[model samples]
Target: MAGQTFDLTDDNKILSLRSPKASISGPYKVVFKNIEERWAIVAIDWDGEPRLAIRWFWGNGGNPFSSGNPTWLVIPSSLSNATLNGLPLDFKLYSKLVDFLAGKITGDQIYI
Candidate 1:
């Protein structure tokens, strides 16, 4: 069975993905939780295996995906970007990420 996705709360908060039994494969069930809301879904990683990363992006209605601050995308302050106050989850990009985790893709597919 496929995993589920969790909706992210706290626009600028950092979210971590973790599984105790799974070998961190493609098609993961995500549960977005923080000091606010809770959401879920199924997503995938494109690289070797997905580690804890920050989700940042542009949202609708002139609302930024993150706050007016910089956050790490990869972890331990590896890749940081100044974004809106929220992290926009791009389904298209996520789909590709899933493919990559499934061993069907690689870094050559990441455009942004």
Candidate 2:
């Protein structure tokens, strides 16, 4: 954790993640996946700093700025307001944002 800055950018894609009981090593993994629609999110606490990678499928007849493939982003959760690809944290993502800010993983806390 020496050289790892707290910046939200620079997603290392290293999906290998650490569980509370497991040690984090090699490539890290995710928090959750197959999110609402056209989007998916994964989180990793690199050396105890929580971060998320939001991926979205831009299947819009090949957008000019992109190849129309799913794009991945590592954004800031510390800002007063956060936006994903210029989108507000509203709509279906609102609930997910709440969980992210509160450091709660809803899917992992459920008891069958």
Candidate 3:
């Protein structure tokens, strides 16, 4: 693996992501699907180092910021329905944040 930096930004109706590669090549593609058909591809900022840029839809109109630790991120729409290691996210959180987000429990509630 190589060291890389990734950033997600916004366009008029799509989200833009920029990626760069220092010493890599061959087959390259965006990380997510539905990029061209569902969303418009805008400008790609490659003025700096070896880089990759992509643009995609910004659906339903919601803030994309996160308010938790870096280890955890607010799930994006493109990934909301995606499974992790073959398990749906809802099941993954059921024993933890699911109850909190569903209002079935609170921070003071104990499950153990």
Candidate 4:
């Protein structure tokens, strides 16, 4: 997914995931506590929405996915520190995530 780009002009615009047909739309927040731990709390305003939050832990090497209603998309990886809604996050990883969410890339390409 390298070299691919996405238009995030609208901060409130959301994108959908392919396989499970999950749609992520609205203003969301991402928080990265450390390089090995991170999580995203997303607002669910769509019909049949699966999860409302996303979590990540690098030590386990697990892929991020929706766990429950008002759900959480958990991702396991080490993401650099950056910012989200004035909070810190991994910009690199965040970029990839934007692409993935925009349908410009696949889940496999979400990591650095």
lDDT for model 2 = 0.37
Q: Report how far residue 39 has shifted in candidate 2, in Å.
A: 1.1
- The C-alpha TM-scores of every prediction are 0.26, 0.31, 0.20, 0.30
Instruction: Rate residue 106 of model 3 by lDDT.
Output: 45
Residue pair clashes in candidate 2 = 15-28, 15-29, 16-27, 16-28, 16-29, 17-28, 17-29
Residue-level lDDT tens digits of model 3 in 19-112: 2223222112222324334322221213321222233334432122223211111233333223222333344343443343344654334133
Each candidate: what lDDT? 0.33, 0.37, 0.27, 0.35
Angstrom error at residue 78, model 4: 26
Predicted candidate 4 versus true structure: per-residue lDDT over 1-112, tens digit per residue: 1001211222222223222335444323332332324323442223332223443333233235334222335222222122233444467866665555445765445446
Which of the numbered candidates is closest to the native, going by highest lDDT? 2
Off by more than 4 A, model 4: 1-52, 55-86
For candidate 2, lDDT tens digit of each residue in 9-91? Answer: 33343232122223222223333433234343454443344455554433442111223222235445664135433444344
Could you tell me the TM-score of candidate 4? Answer: 0.30
**Model 1 C-alpha lDDT per residue in residues 58-80, reported as the tens digit of each score:** 23311112253322233321221
Instruction: Score residue 34 of candidate 3 by CA lDDT.
Output: 40
Q: Rate residue 107 of model 3 by lDDT.
A: 31
Root-mean-square deviation of every model: 14.9, 12.2, 16.7, 13.0
* Stretches of candidate 2 exceeding 4 Å from the true structure: 1-27, 45-49, 60-71, 79-112
